[model samples]
Target: MHPSFTQRVTALEGLRARTRQATAEFYQKPGVMPPPLAPLIIVRSSGNNTFSLINRATGEVIAERFGHNNATSHARELEADIKRFNVKQFGRHLRDWALRISAILFLFAFFGSHA
Candidate 1:
C-alpha cells in the first residue's frame, strides 16, 4: 500500500510511524512537490485499484497511483494533476465530525482493535 499502514498487523504507534514515514518519503520522492497540504489522508479506492494521498481537511487530492499496488510508478504521472486536483476527503460521512486528530487516531485505534 502507498502508506504501508500495516493496519491489521501492527499497533497504533506503528501505524503512526509508518504513516509519518510514508508521508515523508512521499514528499521526498523526486519531482513530487506538494502544496500546503495538512492532515494528509491516504485512500485505497474500494471499487477500483486506485490509491490516493489527499488533504482531508481541504478536500484536495495531492497524488494518485492506479493499480492494485500502491508503490507502482504511476504516481509519477500526477505532477500536473496534483496542481489541479481537488475533491472531498470527508471520508464516508459516517462520522461527520471526524476531525483531523480524531480521524488519524481513529485509524490507529481502529486497526489496533482489529489486530
Candidate 2:
C-alpha cells in the first residue's frame, strides 16, 4: 500500500469517526510530524497501497494516487493536497463566518429597530 493513500484514507476515516463517535479523535504516531490543520489524521502506509484524498463533499479526489514506488514523494504531495483541500473547502469556513456575521447583524437590527 502506498503510504500516501493509507494516510489519506485513514484521515478520512478519522473524520468519520470523529463525527460518529464524539470522543474519538485522530491518533498521531509516536514520532511523526504533527499535521498542520485541526482534526488532522496521519497515516503511514507499508508499501503496497494506493491512495487518494477524496473530497467527501464533492466525491472528487483531491490528490493523485500514490503507488508503491512513490512513497518517498508523498510528503510534499500530501502537504500540497492539504492546502488544496483547505482552499477548495473554504466554503465551510465561509459559512461559519457568515453565521457569525448574521448573528451580529440580527442583534444590531433588533437594537436599531427598537431604538
Candidate 3:
C-alpha cells in the first residue's frame, strides 16, 4: 500500500475514534443536550406552555400531549420501565449510528481517496 493511503487510513481512524468519544461523552455527561433529570421530574419545555417528561438518557418524549398533572403522573408511573428502555435504546442507537458512520468513512477512504 502507498504511504499516502496508509496515512489517510490512520487519520480516518483517528477521526472515527474522536467521533465515537464525543458521542459517548454526549450521552454520559450530565446537563448536555438533555439535562439529567430524575425519573418523572417535573420540567417545562422551552417555547411552549406544555410540560415535558423526557428520558434523560435518550432525550425521548415520554408524554407531552396531556396536561402537566396527567403527564407527570403517568411518567412517574412508568419511570422505571422508561429508564430501562432509555438505557437500552440509547446503547442501540449509539452503536448503530457509530457503526454506520465508520463504515461510510471507511468506504470513502478506501475507494474515494484512491489515487
- Tens digits of lDDT, candidate 1, 7-89: 64467878889999999989999999877643235454635676765556676766676764662344333433554535554
Question: What is the C-alpha local distance difference test score of each model?
Answer: 0.62, 0.62, 0.74
Instruction: Give the C-alpha miss distance for residue 85 in model 3, angstroms.
Output: 12
* Top candidate (TM-score): 2
lDDT (10s digit) by residue, model 3, range 1-115:
9999999999999999999898888878777675576555444564345777776667776567346666667677776665576777989999999999999999989998785
Model 1 regions lying over 4 Å from their true place: 1-10, 37-115
1 versus 2: better TM-score goes to: 2
TM-score of each: 0.23, 0.35, 0.30
Model 1 superposed RMSD (Cα): 20.3
